[model samples]
Target: MRADRLVSLVLLLRRHGRLTAPALARELEVSTRTVLRDIEALSAAGVPVYAERGRHGGFALLPGFRTELTGLNHDEALALLVAGSRRGAQAFGLGSALASAMLKVVDALPESHRDTAAGAVQRLLIDPETDLLSRRQVAEEVPDAIVAEVRRAVFAGHRLRIRYAAVGQSPKWRTVDPVGLVTVRDQGYLLAMRSGADRTYRLSRILAAEELSEPAQRPERVDLDRAWQERSTRFRTGGDQVTVLVRLDPARREELVGTALAVRAEETDADGRLRLEADFQDSRHAVWALWQLATSAEALAPQWLRTALRDRAAAIAASYTSQPES
Candidate 1:
């Protein structure tokens, strides 16, 4: 570990030319005292690294000192830097580790490729919160303390107790043998077994968590992909979902499908709109999703859903027009 830090320290000074002990500490994620010790170690090893004394002073290597770490080509380095810019690592509490690793990647690159790769990445934007239509994406909030407890249990192979708030239910404490953690579209889930039955809990709904020292009873090896697939299939097939046929504006077809469980059929109509048969969790789910399109979406079949929507619309209209009580 010390060897790796020593190497990273050299790389940092090599790339930045001069950095104060405090600055080096920040980059290396260590204390100023540790940075000073590293400098002494480097100098003792015959590497001419010295410190300047004045306010503008810092530690610097002897002029012409450089390390040739050209393992990744220009394109490869660029790819890595770009991938490192993504935000998913935060979900695992590895955000600081990721930042440190990226710094090393940047510093280790050959000088000629380093500057270009770093500069080119500035032009790319990814996964902006507010999309094109100005609707902001809402990210689920999972407190760091809860996430940390759950993560420790999963990685340590221990039993986990969580205060989970299932939809429409009060938060309750339950113990489970955690299998793994999965994140999709910024939402996190804990795939675990409760009383030997498969259960999945949303991380956002985990109000609190405690990692038990007792070892988890899960199999020594797990294929999380397969586990997640089986759980998802069961959930989808078991739900009391309703299938609704709708005539939707062609422009709003994507928006409608985005919230649907499945698109059963599709065809274009004479009016240049889309006739879509889609499945939603239930009548309420169907109505809520379709209502988002306003006049652009019309329920073609399922008279009950259409009636529900009509009554809902009338109520909303009445609310707006009815006079306020004096």
Candidate 2:
């Protein structure tokens, strides 16, 4: 662990040029004393590290000094290249940083492995703009400045004031305690809280943002995965959840389940059709999701849904069957 810290300290200086002891301590999640000790160790190891005295002074490395510590194998290098291909990083305003890091990784590879790894990465495509069906995956637009401020607030545990435009509502300003930022299906969301109540805001919906001087009121250490799960559970259960019983083709069972919020019960009919009880956000959500399956799925219960589907089908049939007067 100490060795890793030493290497990290060197890389931090190499990347940022110079940093004060307090800043280094904050970045390394250690105390100023530990940072000073690490500086002494690095100097003792002939790392050419020097410190400036008085205000406006900090530790810095000798100019043009860089450690060639890139020990990535061919596969590791290719893995990083693949990860860098994702568009999700752009939502968080790290696109250029990711690109630069990938370039550095490629340059640091051994001469013999470089060409092979580069050639292999060329054959693999990730997060393509369009799939074989010619359907485009449009990424949500997030202002670079807004994303940067939100990101800083989340990472630095600072309160954030945002001008948010909720769906069908006028934009308004609100201050939130940022828990974390998440990207799902190319859309970014800031999972935060206002007055201890969960407030999940989409990055695209943020018109503006400012990182506040006051510290955020949140846990020092957050388990993002677990927190996301808990929030997901609350969202799925607390909304106007409607249960839909559906009879679907056995083959399309997964398609129906995947689009639903949750499956309450599932069973197979004797004739081989799949019967599922699924929870949806609301009536409209249920109708829209079921419509995608077309004739492959049927809404079994909730007579109103059946009527709505019947009426919709009748309207469609009427449109096609209408007589044309010439």
Query: Per-residue lDDT for 1-326 in model 1, tens only?
Result: 78789999998888888899999999989999999999999999988899988998999999998765455544344335435435455554444555665777788777988989989879877777788889887767777778878988998999999999999998999999999987777778899999999999988899999999999999999999999999887876786988899999998988898999889899999979899999888878898998899999999889999998999999999898968889
Worst 10 residues of 1 by lDDT: 73-82
Best by TM-score: 2
TM-scores, all models, native as reference: 0.68, 0.74
For residue 202, give model 2's deviation from the true position in Å. Answer: 1.0
Task: Give lDDT tens digits, candidate 2, residues 1-326.
Answer: 88889999999999999999999999999999999999999999999999988898899999999986366544343335446446767777766656666777778777988999999999988778998899999999887889989988997899999999998999999999999987778889999989988888999999999999899988778887888888889889986789999999988878788889999898899999889999998999999888889999899889988988889999999988868777
* Candidate 1: residue 248 Cα off by (Å): 2.2
Task: Report RMSD (Å) for each prediction in the order shown.
Answer: 13.6, 10.6
Candidate 1 differs from the real structure by a C-alpha RMSD in angstroms, to one decimal, of 13.6
Task: For candidate 1, give the lDDT of residue 208.
Answer: 90
